[model samples]
Target: MMQRCFSLLFGMLAWSAAIALEAPAESHPGARAFAAELARDPLAIEQGLSEAAILATLDQARYQQTIIDAISRPAESKAWKDYRPIFLTDKRINDGVAFYRAHADLLQRLEKEFGVPASIIVTIIGVETSYGRITGKYRVLDALTTLAFYYPARAPFFQGELKQLFLLHGTRFPYATTELMGSYAGAMGWGQFMPSSIAKFARDEDSDGKIDLWNSISDICASVANYFTAHGWQTGGPVAVRANVDKNARVITPGSLEPVYPLTQLEEWGYHLGSNPGGAKPDGQTPVTLLQLEGAEGTEFWIVFQNFYVISRYNRSPLYSMAVLQLSEAITRELSKPAQ
Candidate 1:
């Protein structure tokens, strides 16, 4: 009886080992790698996130093929003619005016405090999320995890953002990492700021003791203004102006979007001031750059000033900066006119 009992115990032990071997792996290799990296940080371990828990979170992240496809075709890739109408529509302009009027007191206070224009602030929010109506729906964790591990194009950047998300949740944010939602790139809230941007620029404008950008208009507007001011947005400065190019003018394409030349040098290069001009020509020393955009009628030219460069700092695309500038101008014009 004793021999038989020992034999049954050994068989049960062997079966348990076999079942363990047959079980599927719980974590992906990419997730394991990220988990290992995260475990190396003492703070992450201190935050009560065990390696197993981190791996579980990563395992739940679904790789989004749609996000991969969308990342390849950003609006910034479109030509100015194709891009302008996307953001500068009558609806967007009208909505921006309404949003401005609705939040005029807060906006005026932001403009006074930050030295940034209220119209520009409204235009940024309008262009980013359609006046806070269409903030993205994708889970930020899945987006950042997929992009950080699977998408190789900007993996390092996304990885840093993923780390920032962890740090943000660990430090001040009260929600779970999986609970936050944003763009395919993980840009969150009305301003569509990345996790790193939130960590650095998000503010509790309402003094509610927590930064609630997702629902707080005051926080959203103030955060947007803070980001712009932090990026060196000039107060009461010209953004851009239309320019008349000589029919036979040489097309001087700048290698970068940065303001590399002065207005005097651009005039020497055959770009003359054109219709609906903004500020007067500055002294020969003020830096400016010539911008060429494809219009429906023909090629369009513009002289972009320092403020234009500042706007580009928010989004490195000239088209995006132009769209925001034009939209802001439209809203300002509509607001200036008498209400019918």
Candidate 2:
């Protein structure tokens, strides 16, 4: 629903407003007074969200230097030559194996309950936070507040997320004072969910009253599965498949999310699919996109399926989606190996 809303709103009028929310003064009488005013005029509460005072507060919030630093150092800067070595290290792979083993039961449960593969779930966690070893250190509130109020490109989306976070604070999705730290983009937990995702899909796997994203492995695991399930994950379907395409065939560039043509069309266009079902194309015949990722040997290519598109919903970058898929395959292969 939010996705549709975003798509519709993207083409509409662009509001010119500074995007950051001012950090609430600690127990400031002004904040209390504002809160009381909002409580009294429910309409004001709705309108106050975008009121001049609120926008002023948001604009007045200082830029967090740490957030600026973290967002700048995306893993892709080192090129695939260096980046592949970082994520595909024997240490990281072995650690992933251990993580899978330790959470075998929960992983199995998520697969059974959510119909999303455990390998995919675990791979997402691994790729995002090294299997929960490092889930960022910035305070989520500051991050969301900063991005929502200051980042003009995606301010409305982040502002909605900030609203969701505050709402979560008062609901079943309670948080501890210390554990509410996450990415500078305000994504939380092992799967790095934005606040809206957390509010809508986060589940309490341990049946605890709280749906804590930090430090609670069960909740985090469950939340990951829940997100996949909510976002149209197809159980046991291919996430992606290796494909061979002629140079004359259709070329897929980065950031292409639209499914324009049929599989039969792709075949006529000189693209050869590796997996055919009963000498016929797969059901739905959903259009496939060729994604090229730089690897150690050379350019690696794959035909991404609808499920792969679903993965893109989590992180829009083609590189990120490809990395997550490769990580999943790698972990699954390592798990299938003979035990020592």
Candidate 3:
């Protein structure tokens, strides 16, 4: 008990010292270095933004200590048993079904054009922003700048995103950089797209010549579908199946969700199919990855395929991917019911 109390006190002290050490965003050395890099960056040159323009924008990016606190303890850090319920709630599932019904025509078009399932697309939006009802409360500039200059863990990644923000502002986005809002990690829109994702994957689906993810459902949905299509989302492909593991099943620790083994090979190694969620037979040669999630029942095993991997590209957590798959499954089943 004494040791635990000491640890807690030490943690609080360390946190306080860290916060105290951080200079204001405007005067931070990291912020100045970031501005220096953006001034000479080729993308900034292409955008025709001068050094003054970049500084003018950077000057508005006030660091929020809360963003650092939020990113430090991400929802993905939770166990599968804990994380699943956050997204796969009864309300989220029901809302997904209703959202599907309301946007059936547009969702259908997205699925048809991109070869991605409408249910999957709907689940993405539901999980990301609760169907746009809670897009985020932080400004994109603040979030990105805070993480880029203040958060050292992912400083390089966020710095790149900070640079991309300018490119997006000058080209794809019609709004000012200061007007954009997103998650603490600087992902924008209903889908929570990072600046890089918006640059590469966002679509102008409504033909408005501006991809408005906030108000335009067509653009938001299509942009998500296009991301899937680009990442090799196979039409009619299997997502995941529960695994029946034997006592002799190899204790495999996969480095990533990338499918490296086939079902037949897994079966040879004492893992076989259990609940086939998609009801589609995967070819014995299909590459798959084994996942062990701490489900409500206990430690549950699953054999996930390329389609599952594709979903992981959006956010690398297998737990997140599983929640999305399960939520989409629930929404799909609900949508399939006959209207009373």
RMSD of 3: 6.0
Residue 273 shift from truth in candidate 3, angstroms:
1.2
Candidate 1 displacement at residue 201 in angstroms: 1.1
Q: List where candidate 3 sits over 4 angstroms from the true fold.
A: 1-24, 277-280
User: 1-340 in candidate 3: lDDT tens per residue?
Assistant: 9999999999999998776545446676776667777878886787777877777777777778888889888889888989988998899999998999999999998888889999999999999999999888999998988888878888899989988888887435887888998998888899999999999999999987898999999999999999999999989989988888899788887889999997798899888888665667788999998998887789998899999999999999898899999999999888889998
Tens digit per residue, CA lDDT, model 2, 1-340: 9999997787453432122223343223333443343344554465344345443443333446566566667776655655766666677677778889999998998899999888888888888888888887777767866665456667778767765665555446657423478888888888898888987888888987888777788898888888888888878766666667788876656468444556566677666677652134565477676666677788766667777888888887666776777777788889999998
Looking at model 1, residue 207 earns an lDDT score of 87
TM-score per candidate: 0.87, 0.77, 0.91
Enumerate residue pairs that collide in model 2: 19-149, 19-150, 20-58, 20-149, 20-150, 21-58, 22-57, 22-58
RMSD of each: 8.6, 11.7, 6.0
Ordering by TM-score: 3, 1, 2
Residue 148 of model 1: what lDDT?
Answer: 87
- Per-residue lDDT for 242-312 in model 1, tens only? 88877777678887667789778888888876754455556676678888889878888888888898888
Clashes of 1: 0
Model 2 residue 46 CA deviation (Å) reads 12
Candidate 2 TM-score, C-alpha based: 0.77
